[model samples]
Target: MTPIKDTHPSASSAVESGAPGARVGNFRWVICGLLFFATMINYMDRQIIGVLKPQLSHELGWTDTGYANIVSAFQLAYACGYLFGGRLMDRFGVRRGLSWAAFLWSVAAVAHGLVRTVLGFSIARLGLGLAEGGNFPAAIKTVTEWFPLKERALATGVFNSASNIGAIVCPLTVPLLAAKFGWPAAFYITGALGLGWIVAWALLYDSPETHPRLSVAERAYIEEGRVVTTEAAAPWLSLLRFRAAWAYMIAGLLAGPVWWFYLFWLPDFLQKRYHLTLQQTGVRVGIVYTMAIVGSIGGGWLAAKLIGRGWSLNAARKTSLLVCAVCVTPVFFAASVENSWVTVALVGLAAAAHQGWSANLYTFVSDTMPKRAVSSVVGLGGFVSGIASMGNAQVVGYVVTKTGSYALIFAWASTMYLLSLLAIQILVPKLVDARENERRVVTDDGTSV
Candidate 1:
């Protein structure tokens, strides 16, 4: 996709134009709130299937491999959509780009209710996967357009936490809805919420440059940070050459599937291991995702607090990631624990840590890339991760079907973050803020490295 010629002010130019006024209004926060709702809907819609899997399998008589094929359909489509969606955002801008994506995905969510066979569900999920791919790339672009560097991570964390909220909504409510009204009702109801989000987004959102409701002071406040970058947005292929970009992809490769497993398989795990029904797994899974909400917001808050107090950007970000990695190691015991709550504690801690790790991971794009390039990089990283996640889902299905054990998967998930962290350290060596540098470092091959 060709990049659109959208004019945007760098922080340096805006700061040069005028000093920020006192007592800034928080219209920017209104935008953040909207993003939170959009993310919440996005996760809730994708996860509805996972919540209904046990019932669906029984009703339709799906084999493990059959269910995995459905998941793989979504993952494959999701990877393709993610790769292209970023460029589409860069080409079309958020208002137009995100609205259509959210709309189409909502339609896909509703479509799930009409399907009865394995092939039908896979087709529906493919549509959902393709449409939902644009969600985060657009959200990150919106943040870069609206918030200054100092508050960007916090804004990301706040919006990112909505995924936890969505996860919470599904397990807590999907099973109940299915029990009362049938599984179709669960998809129909959640998909309708996207209509409300579309209305709010169309009416409320605009870039800071043109937002009529935003105060001039708030506009100044949003542009106060120094945004250093190359003279222009980096071309997509050139960006592929950077170690920073690959570091992000590597991190996604390792961790994205683990998160995906939690999203799609946790209900099954809870059910098989404990012989819990959909409703029982609902309560237990709800508790697990509730803890994740804390990680999403708290992780960002901790790193932001550190930066505000004088830690280097690198130190704050990496230390927080390291802390998350260590917390996840406890998951080694998650599948083996006898007490269900004990297992919840171990898995919950890891789930929470994953979100925290995710918050910082997303911020890496905004911190290191120009505002113009942020979505594209985030999209590419997601594409890589989505591909890995596809294989992960299929393998998980096969393993569980053959072995009837979760211990191996949990053990695999436990080590990913440490390896991800190691890749980030080795590839990035030091975090480079794009706002402070004019060009990416390049190797002798003339590629940015």
Candidate 2:
């Protein structure tokens, strides 16, 4: 992620040190690194459930429907939290809000070890969901604060890439940890990692305006060609009225289930489909996420290169998203294939395309919304996504229980991306920011920050 350049005289002067004209040096990279690690911790805690699902289900004597309901419980709470978490981030500012969120989820991750029954596990996962639901709202808000429009997609890509890291690490580590020490101990160790991150975040993170080492040139670059920093001061309710915001919301809702399906079910699916051992399942999931990391970064770079070539920001994003949309459609046919390696390749491509599409979609908010509303808008979208995911989880659970197969599930996963892309096209059709009067307005908004 590129640093934001100073725009105003105050911002410019703040970063200039010693010399008559000196750049503060870019610090956005530092912030991006912090966010990346935080995401790693977030996904690590979340992915443990998938990696341990077989063990957990068997140990707890739970059925597929029961496991699905447990997953649904997390999504249900996450949906509710997403509604409020973004607003909290906007009110409290990213540093404090994210730090608190990280701490909460960390505690919840540890709490997972305490649950022995399905009900107990469900409750613990719900807590984990509520706490983790804050992640994207806080991360995306920081991206808006630190990166310029030109590099926002790439910045988002870097921030999100950490999730792949988390996913990869969890499977590789969790299964082994569970084998050696038991599943509960794995939770304790992963939970502890987040505690260290909370301390690091408190020590390292500050807003762009307050960061000590931001370069004058960097700050200027960020503020240059900016559309909406001051809009953050506007009531977030103002953002609700914007049609463009709804476009993102609807797109998120349609697509959210597909991701949740992968996150919560992929390990179980792989295990059942191939009769793989837990360790093998972990490796497979790890490979998929590792590929996702590449996809996320590569996707962002591809779009930036297009923008650098004089493509409009909207054109670049749309083009990249469309590519991802097209690439993912092939996954639908993958389920019917007989070869295991071919199935892996097809699933990997679909997973990669999802990450690529995600990197661009997250940037879409920063591109269109004023900085102030970014988190809230993200939260709104998350809320809708969370709801769809909750319902989707339950439905999948029932389907899997009734059919004893995931063929239909994989088919849905493959096609959902294309459907979502179409929704985005029909709803948005263009990438321009909505008119100022049409944006969401915060009414009687009050916050700690």
Candidate 3:
């Protein structure tokens, strides 16, 4: 896909004059806020099932295999949804795509509460996964549109941290809600949050060119690094031919499953191995996700700092990702530990590392692709990730069922980040390539629109 071109009245003047005001606008930060809240809701809805796993198992007479099956169904559907949603967002634009995705997923979340049988739950989870899958592709694409290169990482970090909030909220709130109001009620509550966000989003967000509240300065600032025009959209074939797209997709396929595993099963792992009560597990789980928030922001800051100090964006982003990947090694050791607190600490550290890696990775996509194709590439990558996740889901489900433990799962988790690191390194060795025609469609203010 070709980059989204400048549509603002200042487009030609911004490119020709190199004036300071060419790229003015404040709408991006507001868009970022909307994305952040959406993520929070996305994650909360996704993880409610995880928090209620034990209760569901008891009530439904599910064995470990049965629970795993349901989880697998969600992942399976989610993987497919992401593949479709990403492309849809790229084709239709984020505003419409996200609105549809949110509505579908919110409906699915409520449907989750209505299921009575194993088959029913599986179907509901699949729908939820399908609907929720579009989130990252859309959000990351939005970030690329709204932010400059230097600020992209931090902006992505801020938006990505919402996942941690969702994770934290799921454990802290879902269980209590489930206990007091029943599991179905928990679904309804989370579903309602999505609807509220959808309404607010519809009312508040639009393209920078269209947003009325955007200050002249803010709009100019955002339009600075953009490279395409509204009237002459870039061809999708141009983006599809880029090697960078392949690199980003490979990275996503490798890492997506790792994150999905953590989101779907970590709480159950704590309960099964360490014998923690649901309430106790909830508190510890909250801590793990809380640490993830810290990592996301910190990792983003570090990468931006490295870029500022003359490091190549590739070097800076990959270095941070590799470090985070290595940190996951400790989790394998953590899983073998007998002490509950020590186990929590180690897993928590690993979770934080995952977030840090993810924060930079999200930025990495923005760095590699033109703004127009960001969502499209993200969609394609999400599709790859979705397929990869299916294998991971089935494997983890079968492993947990057969072994009756999370030990093997932890071992796989420990090595996943390292594998992703290698894939990123071997696949895309450079940050910028002159052969790729690194030309910025310069607006007069030195903005690359």
Candidate 4:
């Protein structure tokens, strides 16, 4: 809990001197762009299976239970990978950690093209989940390193919106690829997309201080008011002591399953509820996820704007979260509505709200924790989310088999964000910076004693 001092003397001096009138540059935004694309590709790769589930089920004779098992394999592997991936990113740094993760997941994505049986697909999904787990940890850490505290939520929101973009891309392209080339081609094409990102990442990414393209003013600007940690990577288990960490974990436990349900089962829901064809499902699903893109950016922007206008960070973040939770409540009516587009609009609103909530939720880590602990804490939340997602897959499969309706699942999703918000409020009543606490005690005369 003790604050670690900034170890880089030059950076500290630069900050203290107000960067000496150095001209600011926009290089940090360039880094944010890369994160956006990486996330887009990550989700596209994962979503291909969901888009093709019906075709695969019919062609291969997969029961709902069987399909759930396949999804469960991925979630289970993701849970394991999130724990280790966060630590690895902390130990090895984002550049190398993200490169390896992209490479491994891409290979796994391509491997799906060669698999035909349920077992084969499950194995490929397991690999995909393990490798893909590193994406958010590395991306979140990069945002911490690149952006200032005030801008972190907006940056996180912008990059996080790529998830919806990826979701959008999957439906638009996956159906065409499956219809034209084969379902396997969908996997092959999306998997190859990550390699291109790897090259760009290797070429363009580095720490702000070390990055060749970064300006002195920008570096100083980013460093100002930031807690520069010089400590070794904190153990993942050690993070559990903080109430902030528990708040994040519980939020993920409640909200992660809802997102998972949308990602994996929405296509099935469309097909069952409205009797849409593959192409029709693709278009409608795209519409739903597109709304999420708007929510993600809007949510992040709202909080950032409020913070800029003199709102406390805690108030701004929590206020955005409350808005998102209210937006999600209308989805409770989605299952009862007779019109399909009406249903899409309702579900879309909920999905959008989820993204908005997620954008701020992610920013909470960098806002409250020290720089060194950001990736590890993010990894812990993801680990909890993955476990919850695994259980959700099983429950969804069971519910579908028993009742032959998505109403029960929709009801649960509708209320999760509000529930999560309450848990967050209870656990972390205020967002307190750990490093700020460490500086609280000074001499009576205000000089270091």
Q: What are the root-mean-square deviations of the candidates from the true structure over C-alphas?
A: 3.7, 4.1, 5.0, 4.2
Q: Which stretches of candidate 1 lie over 4 Å from their true place?
A: 1-21, 228-233, 436-449
lDDT of 1 by residue, 110-207 (tens): 99999899989999999999999999999998998888877888898899999999999899988789889989999999789997799999999887
**Cα deviation of 268 in candidate 2 (Å)?**
0.9
- State every prediction's TM-score relative to the real structure: 0.93, 0.92, 0.90, 0.94
lDDT value for candidate 2? 0.80
Candidate 3, residues 1-449, lDDT tens digits: the string is 22444455444555456665545555677889999999999999889888888888898898777777787788778877876787777778888999999999999999988888889999998999899989988999888777777778888888898999999988998788877878899999889989999999899988766778876566666665455544222244555556677777787787778888888788888898888899999998999899889888878888889889999877888888888888878888766888888888888888888888888887777787656556767777777887787778778878877878778878777887888778777777876521132343233344443
lDDT of each: 0.86, 0.80, 0.79, 0.88
- Candidate 4 lDDT over 1-449, as tens digits, reads 34555544344566557655465668899999999999999999999999999999999999999999999999999977887898899888999999999999999999999988889999999999999999998889999899888888889999999999999999989988888999999888888899989999999999897887887778877877665645356655556657788899899999889999999999999989889999999999999999999999999999999999999989999999999999999999888888989999999999999999999999998777667777888899999999999999999999999999999899999899999999999988988875663343233344421
Sort the predicted structures by lDDT, highest score first.
Answer: 4, 1, 2, 3
What ranges in model 3 sit over 4 Å off?
1-27, 230-240, 433-449
* Candidate 1, position 326, lDDT: 90
Quote the RMSD, in angstroms, for model 1: 3.7
Ranking by TM-score: 4, 1, 2, 3
Q: By lDDT, is 2 or 3 better? A: 2
- Point out the higher-scoring one by lDDT: 2 or 4: 4
Query: Per-prediction count of colliding residue pairs?
Result: 2, 28, 27, 0
Worst 10 residues of 1 by lDDT: 1-10
